[model samples]
Target chain A: MIMTVTLTILCLLLILCFVTTSIIPTPVGACASLIGGFLLLSFIYGFLGAHFAAVIQIIVYAGAIMVVFVFVVMLLNVPTQDLPKVKISLADILSILLSIPVLILVSIKILNWQAPMIDSQNVEMKDIARKMFIDYLWPFELISFLLLTALVAAITVAHKNKGSRYMLKEGSDHGR
Target chain B: MTIIFSIIVFAMVLIVGFHVAPLMTWVERRQCAFIQRRVGPNRVGIFGFTLFGLGQPIADAVKLLFKEDGNPSYVQPFFYFIAPLIPSVTGLAALMVIPFGAQDTFFGTVFSPQVLSVGAGFLLFFAMSSMSVYGVTLAGWSSNNKYSLLGGLRASAQMISYELGMGLSLIPIVLIYQTLDLQQIVYAQSHSYLFGFLPDWGIFRAPVSFFIFLITIFAETNRLPFDLAEGEAELIAGFLVEYGGMRWSLFFLGEYAMMFAFSGLISCLFLGGYSLPYLTHESLIHIVQPILGSFGSIAVFLIEFATLIVKMSIIMLIFVQVRFTVPRFRYDQLMKLGWVTILPLALINLFVTALVLGYSSFK
Candidate 1:
């Protein structure tokens, strides 16, 4: 009962963080909240016996990947451009009104859902490596190849540079 | 009951962490002074009795706490306020997971010295340490100062870059030890020497990992040579340009505390953690049991804890010595060091370790 209550609170906090991320006007604040949400999600994964997944989530997502995300956002200095008026519009209200029944249905499903039995209660790093490399080896290799192609494509597109544009005025701040 | 034990142990760790912040200030100052061939701050003391400047940090703390917390009207209220928190909170949180001493019974409630002990508890340090990026970035972004933002981003960027190499370096150790449990890794080191001279420590087993981890710690902690973030000369204290008084001090305190924690971590991972060079815990307990009698367990626990602290302090002193000696890395140099140099070397080290391990096992 206590464990259930704790997980419930964690899930609620996770939702709160995501909501905060979307609602916050500043880019940095949004990014921070997103990191929090990811951490909470990782914690929930940990509670669900995905120990390898939990730590990797923090290390890869919140740690390395999001740092790069924040770096790009900061480098671009887009918070000024992005900080539009955060008012609920007719489109937002209409979307919400349209989604109410779906939301309720989803909530009902979530509430009624039972957690699956975790066969491996103590999932170690080796078990994860085995599953990824040996069990689902083709999928893993295919995914890596796909990611490599994406990276190559991204570089190809980036290198084409129709015209390089500057965000901040030349005299504003010299980061370099 | 388990929860209660965890809470108590956690609180103890917090106290140690909290105290470490101020103590490190003294260590840095005194050690730097010693390196420079001068008597540093041998003045502040209780009732005018300067105890070799032991009271200096306390005096500094009092002054900082009382000074005006210059909360500028222009800064983003929430991020500015919460920015200092992430570093300190993450440092303390990381401390909770670190195994300071062996398990001991206190009032019949036997508990591990650490709060949380998982299969891969060691990685939790990186996980917590990694979150400190937000603290720097948030401080920069919310401060409404371009220079602060640049500084913050630079610092955060350095941390992120170094973290990759640091995490990669540990793979070899994990391969050699064959467990992610930090306690198990430490226990694995306690067996005996490899040959007749070499000790069975992580450093001996994986010298490349040790070197990589050392360099990355310097980068991760934002210490000198790698401390371009607060380039006292260039960025005017970096992301901390807008901060003052207690707020400014909190950043340093957090850094120092994290440094101490990392020292503890390095000792655990590389050095013979909480164990004598040659003696195991059982032997140590056996040796001391005759002298202390019924207080054997408690005595051993204190000794282990002290051993860990002593090892950490040695690292802390090295930090101070290096800070005073080395010149700060140029921004490009720092980036190059992390990426062009350390990252590839770590990868090579990882692959070599795996190949060696596989070959040895197969043979």
Candidate 2:
């Protein structure tokens, strides 16, 4: 009964977050709503006994990624732009129609699935660490490599244009 | 009964956390004055009754409470109002998992001084403190001022950069103690002695980590030398430029609360948390039991509690002293210290600690 109540509240919060994200006019507000949604999702993960996953979700996603998003939003300092006029174009209708079947399929699959009962009150970090290093070692290492690749890509993208821009400015000054 | 005791303890923690701001305010004022060769706060009550300006914090609080509460026209109302609250709430929440003294059973109920005795206390602290960046960032953004925006950005970036060093520094501690639970770490420290003389505290085991951790602590709290977020000459109070009255005080309270909490954590981690050198609870009990009979245990508990508080206060004093002694760092210099210097040093410290521990155990 308690679990049912908790899940119900979480579902309500998730819906509220989704609505807020859509309705909020400002970029910062939308980002805040997205963070709220992530937090709620992590709480649900915690409820499902994925304590380590829940914390990683908060730390890596909500804490780090969303912070950068907020930083960029502030940096851009975009004036409040009105929401784009909603038009039910052919593409939108087609996409909505296509999504309905997928949504239904997902819901049906979820309803048919049974979650495994976890008797442990708390998942130990050691257990998670052992599993990460042992059973999931290859996947974990792959993820780290993927993260490193992304970091390098980001640095390259940021650095590539700066040198050329500086060179063009220097050339213009020299010509004058 | 346990619930009631926990409630009491939680209330005490909140009261202490809130009061720390005013107390530290007086301490800072007096200390700064003394360093500058000026008389500080000596006219409030007597010898002018100034109580050495001890009453200054109370005066400041009253002044702040009575001052006009102003909201600027351009500010985003929601974020502006909520921003100050974030730091204080997160600061207090971080304090919940810190065990201040030895666990005791009274009237058939086991009571630990900590409000939340979770297994992952260390990570919880890091997570909450990391979240505090949002408050400063949002405050700066919502103010709709350029200075505030820049301040917020610098603060957030600085915090994020230093957190890497902070976490890496802690790796050696976790590796040594082999537990994330703060209380368990404290217990481990109490049982061992270094070379049969000094307490086998974290500092003794991982001095390099301790040094890196000390630097990160200063950075984490955004104290002097690291207070680029609110550089008065450059940013004009940074994120707090628009805040006034009670709202500004809330941010002030939050910073001091975090300072106290971090000090407690440092004492718990590097110092022999709640234990005097060469004096475990058992040793204390052995000495006091014959003199006081059944009251020895109670005496020991009080002594342990006092020891922890004194240690924390000493750490706080160091924080205040360093704030006055060291000049603020340049923005780029601050970044270099965290990312370039502390980060690599912490990584090397972790590696060396692991190597030494492994070799010793094998031998």
lDDT of 1 by residue, B2-39 (tens): 67877877888888889988888887888888888999
Backbone clashes for every candidate come to 0, 2
TM-score, predicted candidate 1 vs. hidden true structure? 0.92
What is the fnat of candidate 2?
0.20
lDDT: worst 10-residue window of model 2 chain B: B44-53
Off by over 4 Å in 1: A79-105, A116-121, A153-176, B1-5, B104-109
Best by DockQ: 1
Note the residue pairs that clash in candidate 1: none
Listed in order, each prediction's TM-score against the native is 0.92, 0.92
Candidate 1 chain B least-lDDT 10 residues = B190-199
lDDT of 2 by residue, A1-176 (tens): 67766876897898899789987778899988998898898788767767666767777788788888898878767665433555679998899899999989988986675545554456688888888999999999999999999999998887876647554455233111
| lDDT by residue for model 2 (B1-363), tens | 999989988998899889999999888878888889997776665345656667777788889999999979999999999999989998888877678777877557877788876545577787778778888999999998888998999988888898889999999999999988888888888866656777889999888888888889888788997998899999999999999999999988888888888988888999988878776767777898899886766777778878988998898888889999999999989988888899999888888889988999999
